[model samples]
Target: MTRTRSTWSLDSMPDQSGRTVVITGANSGLGAVTARELSARGAAVVLACRDMSKGEQVTSSLPGAEVVRLDLASLESVREAADEIRGRHERIDLLVNNAGLMMTPRGVTQDGFELQVGTNHLGHFALTGLLLDRLLVTPGSRVVTVTSLAHRWGGGVLDFDNLQAERGYDSMGAYGRSKLTNLLFTHELQRRLAEARAQTIAVAAHPGLSRTSLARYLPLPVRPFIAAGTWVTGQSAAKGALPTLRAATDPTAVGSAFYGPSGPGETRGRPVAVGSSSGSRDPEAMRRLWEISEELTGVRPRFVPASAG
Candidate 1:
């Protein structure tokens, strides 16, 4: 089915007068910019970050925003953040699972999994499931997951045996696996939500390689090249936020849809809806990942539809 299309303009975007948007890693870069934009458009925004102090400092100058603590690398933190979010709001209009760590040293999460996969994908997976009820209760609700072009190269084969990369984990490999899982989760979650008669939309988008503080983990020398590449071609974090904003706030957005740039090689340009590879939609792989996710985080059971028969 062809989904409706929504174009994003600072003006044309939804008024969001009464909507509440929760953005992970909202203290900086794309997350921060997204929070600022959503706030500017008159939405109540919850900035979920690892540093409550930074979150508070950042939002102190911005109205219609709140700061809460979240560390995607820690399941306890994720659960605590979920509880905090659930307490203040009965419904959530938008949930932006936008926080991530890039190419960190080989390590495990607070839950004892490889850092990248654990934080980028698993943490958000649990958060989404925990908050699913509120999202379902909220009218016109949507979940926007931010991925990367590296996802094409980063998300490796779905490995059930070495799920955490505990055996010889490569930094970029784990990162790719996590991102590919993002799309897989997006498509599969949408399918399950539909079968359950849930009204929430699930969409995915990539920033198209912008230079942001999120990339600080890269070696200092490489930072120069990345900065040059982004400066030569990358858009500002504020501009890079369009795809997520479009996916989150755009009325035409739908479950399973992907968004990226309208520029050269989709590296930089306006945000527009896009497509994904067949690998991202493999049902068998997605089911395995879903089961593994539940096992790891103790989040909601993978959405079981009436048609599960």
Candidate 2:
């Protein structure tokens, strides 16, 4: 029952009733759209956002929706958010690592890692690890991380030595590396879940070139061109949200499967099962990134032990 057709839409997604979903960055853009859609289908959606006011704005229309403050750049905030969510919900059916930063000026997170990787990869990494126990115990739970086509940027491989960009910094390059880490993390997590024989699965998806406010951090000289390009080729935030929604709810979606727009260059259109760059498929790279993430975040997922013979 894999959704192979090019016409797959939100309407085709299975009913999500009785499930509890936690989505980071649900204040706006693709995150907001995803929160709305899943809530419509009867999910008790918790909107994890850095900005409470903005997050609150989106919750009024949806019954049973709650907002939790989550600042992905700060590990303390991430931990607090996870604790609050766990305190409120006994079971988390889905965890959408949807918050991210695009090409932005050189900076570091509260924990001092490079900004993009910190917020986009490390922050989500810690959050997932902290909240994993709930998901591990919940039957058929999933962790769906939203990655990007930019993952293939700047050669599509992670610069292990310069992951924090201490040697140098290129805005776009750092963003790409963080995204590459996202895919690598997803694959490695899936592998671990399989090894543990846990029911929780990890999957990845990308919105393609959706028109979101993520590009606000790009350089001034590049803003107009990027804006024009998005205007001409980008899909709405709701449309961009489709790939993530599909990955989150598609019953046929399995661990390590990726979803993205099926259009030319994967820029825009209906979402379908898509392949990641060969680099993203490398087992060594995934393992290394996972180890680094665990060390940096000081959090390791605790899954149920594999059955004994």
Candidate 3:
């Protein structure tokens, strides 16, 4: 039987004494909660944050925690952070791409992409490629990415013409595109990993509308509805992190297993294995997205060594 949410607890998690975990956007919110829960299980937790001071302060409170500066909005920062990780660790057991921005004012990334797309999707994409070798070095390693339910709104349609929102800014539209990309990216990466028979698994997860700082971007008019939804079914950040935690560490998790809350409306249950939108599973779109990622990021995920596969 699969492990249900009720079966999982920080205390019941597997002993991770020798394992290492890296969580992005670990300064606060769901990422921080996941870090704490994993650290409780004895994993050497690395908190990658945009703010050094915040990362340091939060990490100091957790056992076996380290802070690393990583601003995912900028490609330069992503490269630097990845290099630093390579220099620091000989092997990486798990990577949780949990950092994200929901909606933001019109802005362009250092790489000249829209801020939401560049940060939420592209940053994680580049980071995953950079760390593929380290993750593939060990068996049972996994890469878990945090997406959002907002992905459903886009129906997997990518407006490439306005990738940077050069036309106009629609915060929700930009956010939706980024999340849809996350799901597609996860599926595509998993397909490639399977083709190569790699040991590393790639999975996608979502918090299912939990009350996170991610909503700081929405317009004031919609805040009440979002808040009411949160009040009705929103779980705590720790609870919200269940799907991601499961994706990252659960033994039964396989490539392409998208996890999310399994309660009524999928908004407030403990983490449970779930399915992504059919639109996200489009192989053609997935392949195209992968190709675009390679071109935009200027890095391809190197294949796992045959000996390790």
Candidate 4:
């Protein structure tokens, strides 16, 4: 199969008929745009959100769209939502781990983990693990996790000892760590999937600097500065969603591949396969993080080890 690299956009998305896509945080921002377009393409889309009211609002506008309450901050909520999804759908063609918390006020989740890392990384880790069976059974299924440009900051370190940021905290630092973990998880997962010879693949994408509510947590003093930067570098939520949509649907996309904007600094443009920090690709860090995540989430993936395979 000859795979030609070309400029990819939303228009390039193929028809998604008979496919079921579950998108976390599908109520607004990039998630909403992704859901709307996928639904328009004839896919049965599930909006997994923390707020049913907001999810309902988004669902009302899109045909074949439904809401499932999923609070990523609470492992209990993730378990319940996964159970509901498994009960309803025999196979899941796509799972977009798009829900996340940006730089927010210092806080901890019900699970006693730092809010950002808990919601962005651990939550998605557990959800994917719980739903692995369904995905593996569905031929060509893919898991597209949403990361960020912020991942480039903070030296791409996992900081396991301070994983919860209890010793000290910097809002952006915590968020950066979480995003970095997203990439690490993607790499490790793809490795495991390949080892198991599963039909499912794990990929990742980033929205670049999109104008969305995810930035609402920025300090008031820096709001104007962020607004100006966004005005110069940011793209609309619809455009910001292209990379994710591409990662989810592009036939040429491969396991462990990352999609992001094609512009300078990858801030805004059409979607293209991009590179991540070398640290994100470190095998040792990836393995350790995977082990810690399994311990924290209590949802271990059923995959043959590389050596065993």
Per-residue CA lDDT of model 2 for 98-195, tens digit only, reads: 99999889999999989999999999999999998889878899999999999999779888989999988999999999999999999999999999
Model 3, position 308, has a per-residue lDDT of: 57
> In model 1, which residue pairs have backbone atoms overlapping below 3 Å?
154-176, 155-176, 155-177, 230-234
Q: Which stretches of candidate 3 lie over 4 Å from their true place?
A: 1-12, 306-309
Give the least accurate 10-residue stretch of model 2, judged by summed lDDT.
300-309
Better model by TM-score, 1 or 3? 3
Cα lDDT of model 3 by residue, 1-309, tens digit: 243544554554677788889899999899988998888888899998898898888888888688888999888999999999889997899999999988888888888888998999999999999989889887788999999888887665666676667887899898988999999999999999889888888999998868788778778989789888887778878789888888887787889998888777678787777766777888888998889889999988888654654
TM-score of 4: 0.95
Better of 2 and 3 by TM-score: 2
Provide TM-scores for the models: 0.92, 0.97, 0.94, 0.95
Please write out the lDDT profile of model 4 over residues 1-309, one tens digit for every residue.
122354776678899999999999999999999999999999999999998998999999888688999999999999999999999998899999999999999998889989999999999999999988878878889999999989878777677788889888899999999999999999999999998888889999998889999888998999889978997888999999999999999998899999888887788888888889888899998999999999999999896432333
User: Top model by TM-score, which number?
Assistant: 2
Best to worst by TM-score, what's the order? 2, 4, 3, 1
Q: How accurate is candidate 3 locally (lDDT)?
A: 0.85
Query: Between prediction 3 and prediction 4, which has the larger TM-score?
Result: 4
C-alpha lDDT of candidate 2 relative to the true structure: 0.93
Model 1's TM-score against the true structure: 0.92
Ranking according to lDDT, highest score first: 2, 4, 3, 1
Least accurate stretch of 10 residues (summed lDDT) in model 3?
Answer: 1-10
Give candidate 3's TM-score: 0.94
Task: Please say which candidate is ahead in lDDT: 2 or 3.
Answer: 2
List all candidate RMSDs to the true structure.
Answer: 3.3, 2.2, 2.3, 3.1
